[model samples]
Target: DPPLPRDVWLASTEVFLARGSAGSSDGLTLVAKGGHNGEHHNHNDVGSFLVAVDGVPVIVDAGRPTYTAATFGPDRYDIWTMQSAWHNVPVVRGRTQPAGRDATARGATAEIGDDASTFTADLAAAYPDAGLDHWRRRARLDRVAGRVEIDDAWRFADDAPTGDDTLLHLLVAGDVRLETGGARVIPEGGARPVRLRWPEDVAATAEVRHLDDPMLTEVWGGHLTRLALPLASRTQLQVTVELDTPIEDSP
Candidate 1:
């Protein structure tokens, strides 16, 4: 079958909520579900939440069990990837700290510290009604490209560091629109066929087009593209073409 159109928004949503969460009113609560045998590894059972506190929304998860409240002081947010059960575990909205090196060697680790007493004191002084559970929501946006070339750097609002071979989801706020030419769909191996194309005036050894029919959404066929170069940490990348456009509603 021919590859379907790409849905950039849905892909972003998957990336945004890749970490699970538990619903809460004032604060967000994340729970890691799975057997505590300390033997097997499981990613599907974990969950997270984005809590709104003092007008600052933060994400909380139970993925990094090796970390403690002490590891994260009072103030500052951070993103970390830890080695747990032989997997690179991603922990968002946590504390930050300096470390020598990771013993697991699975991935990079990040830490953020928050002075419990000082943080509480500041919150209490500013918003008397604000409690520890009070947190704000975070604004996130993302996008994916299949074959086009990008010029700018990609920025991650969250403190998570960007690295080569890191699978990412580009999230956007509302619907998006884009245009492209000379696109085609092709299937790889046993996986679903993908949309592909070549630019009109670009010279390259291989074809360069957006990946159509990304498995995430039905909007723009969920185009998937790769980075020509590694994305810089906390930097925004410029896209020359509309690889993954957004749609408010789809048929």
Candidate 2:
């Protein structure tokens, strides 16, 4: 099999897709987005991402539910799936990202290469009321290393809430099992399991949401799981994701 084309960066959309070559047993792909919160039919999910191993989405996006009368109303964000806390984003100071074009990403950059693909952006503007001076999120897919690393570093304003106030979330279409310093995501179907490792200081937890809505169930089957990591009382957090190598690639 030939190598896949290099990673893609959509500058206008502020979305990046990074992946290993097609022939690589480590068929890992990461899709990350950084755009304004006020997109049409949008979720308050700037700096959100998804992970797929061997073409199966493990860390995923819980797609929008069926449109209701209130779907486009002022209460649109009241829906859990429309909130940043439920998406693969950080909730800072207990505040989800605000919805508006004013709430946008800044200083976004991407570098596509054979060794690694990287996308980085400052997300502080996406949380207008979160009292953040800067929230820098870096998503890097290292083809040589066979892993994807998400690094988030932030600086809080003086008045921002103190004590473990930052929580990162990743929604998954899989079974999640907690381990020593991280968790393993075994995607339903026949996809290889993916490991999500975090810093020792971060506390990892999982939540399962059963999908009763037909719109959601049709795509995700019965349910989805959310892996939540509450950062230590600190300014930075890094989550590394690794996909198991195929048997043929083993020594």
Question: Number of the top candidate by lDDT?
Answer: 2
Highest TM-score model number: 2
What is candidate 1's lDDT per residue for 159-236, written digit by digit as tens?
A: 446444322112111112222422222211122222222243322121122423232223223332221222324233
Q: Residue-wise lDDT of candidate 2 within 33-126, one digit each (tens)?
A: 9889878889888888888888788888888899998799999989988988889988888787888999899988898888999999999999
- Model 1, backbone clash pairs (residues 3+ apart or across chains), number: 54
Cand. 2 TM to true fold: 0.91
Candidate 1, TM-score vs. the true structure? Answer: 0.17
In model 2, which regions exceed 4 Å deviation? 1-5, 22-26, 159-162, 245-251
Q: After TM-score superposition, what is the CA distance of residue 85 in candidate 2 from its true location, in Å?
A: 1.0
